[model samples]
Target: MLDSNETIVAIASPTTPAMRGIVRMSGQSVVPILEAVGIKSSQAKRAQVIQSRIDLGTPLGKLDIAVSLWPTSQSYTGQPSAELHTIGSAPVLQSIVNVLTTAGARAARPGEFTMRAFLAGRLDLPQAEAVLGVIEAEQRGSLEHALNQLAGNLSRPLEQMRSEMLDLLADVEAGLDFVDEDIEFISDEALVERLSVIHAAVDKTRQSMESRGGNRSRAIVAFRGNPNAGKSHLINALVGREVAIVADVAGTTRDVVSVETTLDGHAVQWVDTAGIESRAQHDPLFEITAASQAHALRASQNADVRIWCVDACHDDLAAQRRYFETHDGSSKRSSIDIWVATKSDLIDSTQRQPDWMYTSVITGDGVDRLRDRVSQFVASHDKEEVGSIMGTAARCSGSLAHAATCIETAIRFVQQGDGHEFVASELRVAVECLGEVTGAVYTDDILDRVFGRFCIGK
Candidate 1:
């Protein structure tokens, strides 16, 4: 929207003292700008690299640079584009940018390059956000999620859903237009089924977005169970250090102990909570046990994943069941529930529970398996929710929720024998809502919110 016909330029590479740097330019005047800056061979460009020198004079006389050109209109921005590769000297790059600006190119705004790509249909709204995700990704998991979004993992399905909705809307409107013909465009059962599918899809997407809103920054794994169940030792083993104090005494960990580390390319916080036990209210230590229990329950409630540690040698199946039943209502349940039989080395293989992971910090029996299960659970939390649109999830959640509501309403109308006109109207609203997700119905404000976070020269 910002004068696409005019040329824009920026230094594409990091402003560091390195062996190479890049100045990127795009628009109709890319070739002319190069020619004006003394690159004569740019005029004959057809997606070729041209070697040239710029006569800066004075402090820096002539410097050699290579210019890679996409002279045709099939480039990243769907316009003529080029990049000047040279030494990664900040001053030198700034000077080259200044020279290009003086030769008829304007300095690019933040996220302007990707914004242009979005405007030119090279990338959708979700994909544009993924570009930023890739830029700001701190770990490999985040990067992979962003890369998948950029590759249309989120957009493709929404696009397909939109297409199907459009077909349904057309049929509804057609039925309304020919009401007197007594023709059935879609059966009530079929319409309800289709609408339900759309509603389910939209709801799933909305829930996924909500899940990301709470834990997008990192995953919380809480270690909890009866005192002296080896919870502290397990935490230390997983973190590869003694982050939590371990002891044979029950209730030794009277507070929440947490440590941050990377597991399977994801930022994970390991939380060790106090052992769960009951003390008489009249006991002098009642208040202490009560406070520790409260903290443990709070940590368990807040955790994204929970690992229940049971003493393999002492706790029987009945005790494990009672432990779970007593603490089930303590907090909001974790998305993943893991049972761990700790101190496995103290017992034989026949003592292991089939459904519980067995581990022993003394011998390191099932620590790696438990760690893998936690990592896999965290990674696949919302994978099916439109390919886990990591970065765009929060942004599009409202629209997706609204779309689901609209579909639900339309389905009710169809079931209640409402006129086709009403059904068509609701479907129209749902279609527009989906369009907003993919930039097919975006406003300038949405564009600003999406592209504003991008760095210049993307």
Candidate 2:
């Protein structure tokens, strides 16, 4: 999938009119292509751009251009590579690409440049994926995180672990090889200790990916409650905009409405869902409303924090308890629950002041407090993840998790007095899993899935 034998050429800039654009060529024919464009020998490893117009083919007109050359192995692709800086025009770039192809260079494929780097051991699988993350960064935090990944902060530990695993596997395999002689090449005590070390490292990596690395996915904060509990109003209040429709009618919100915001540079999804009710709890098979409620419940379940709103004017404390009871705060990835007393302005001394945040949309009181609290919640939950050592990629995370599973099974095998061959086999599988995450091992299918998201010529 990563064929780097032939010289490849591509316009590396956006195909739009701009002040400048880059055209990249890599591999063996790069020198000839550079010379064909009138580059001097001293231009190697220099950023200086030589200005000139060269004859591109007979009828294709001369183009004023500048060339930056990296004539040795230190290039991005770890081979001879050059960049053509020219006026930004799609046709002009295509013409230049055509001229280069005529000079025995083929057009580069999507992500071929970075893929070449990965293939040539310039970047591992995680760092390669980080390139896409860097390109697709929606904010500063994500961009910095991508840069961290590109710097190999995540790959170093995984490589170390893989190295240790390799040594242990070798020792176990040696025992398996001499089983007929009853030779204990690696003792049960020593094997147990070694496996325990690898197991802890694998488990630590898994937990980091699950928690601190979790910000790689969207963080959802939801407003949920009984009908007309000011859920929509609260959402608008918190986001500082009227994204959700505000109304006095019961069951006004029959669907989930979302608005995105950033708190402390961390992205947040503020979700407003359909009001909770007994009918929703029933979730009748024939009802469409039940489906929307189910969706809301799922969203709430999956949210990082759920704001449960109860109106101060009404008394549904018993029903709210029942609602919280059935949901059973116990869940995998369970959301943090915040009880909120809404319509605080209408509350009189007779009304019971619930042990929760009091909010009043009419008076704009407590809205700022809510916003600040939400911001604090998001910041506290995700602040540590920004620019973390481990790069967040779902595919890589999954591989690590599966690798941990394999290691745990191997540990169990060792503890159960399993055969050296069986334990060794499990170790081999686990090593391969870790290798996939770091790109020390790869397949065409894996490469396709990893690089397919990259733009052409990246």
Q: Name the best candidate (by lDDT).
A: 1
Q: Name the best candidate (by TM-score).
A: 1
Q: What are the models' TM-scores?
A: 0.67, 0.62
RMSD of each: 14.3, 15.1
Backbone clashes counted, model 2: 0
Residues 1-458, candidate 1, lDDT per residue (tens digit)? 57878899999999979999999999999888889989866345478888989866678878999988998788998889998999999999999998999999999988988988998899999999989877876555556677878999889989988999999999888888888997988888998999899789888877866776545446789988888999999999988998998777888999899999888766688999998888898999999999988888888887778899888887575577566857757553325678888899998898667777889998989999988998886665434222335448767888898899899999999899988788889999999999999999999889888888889988
Candidate 2 TM-score over all chains jointly: 0.62
How much does candidate 1 score in TM-score?
0.67
Clashes of 1: 0
* Local distance difference test, each candidate: 0.84, 0.79
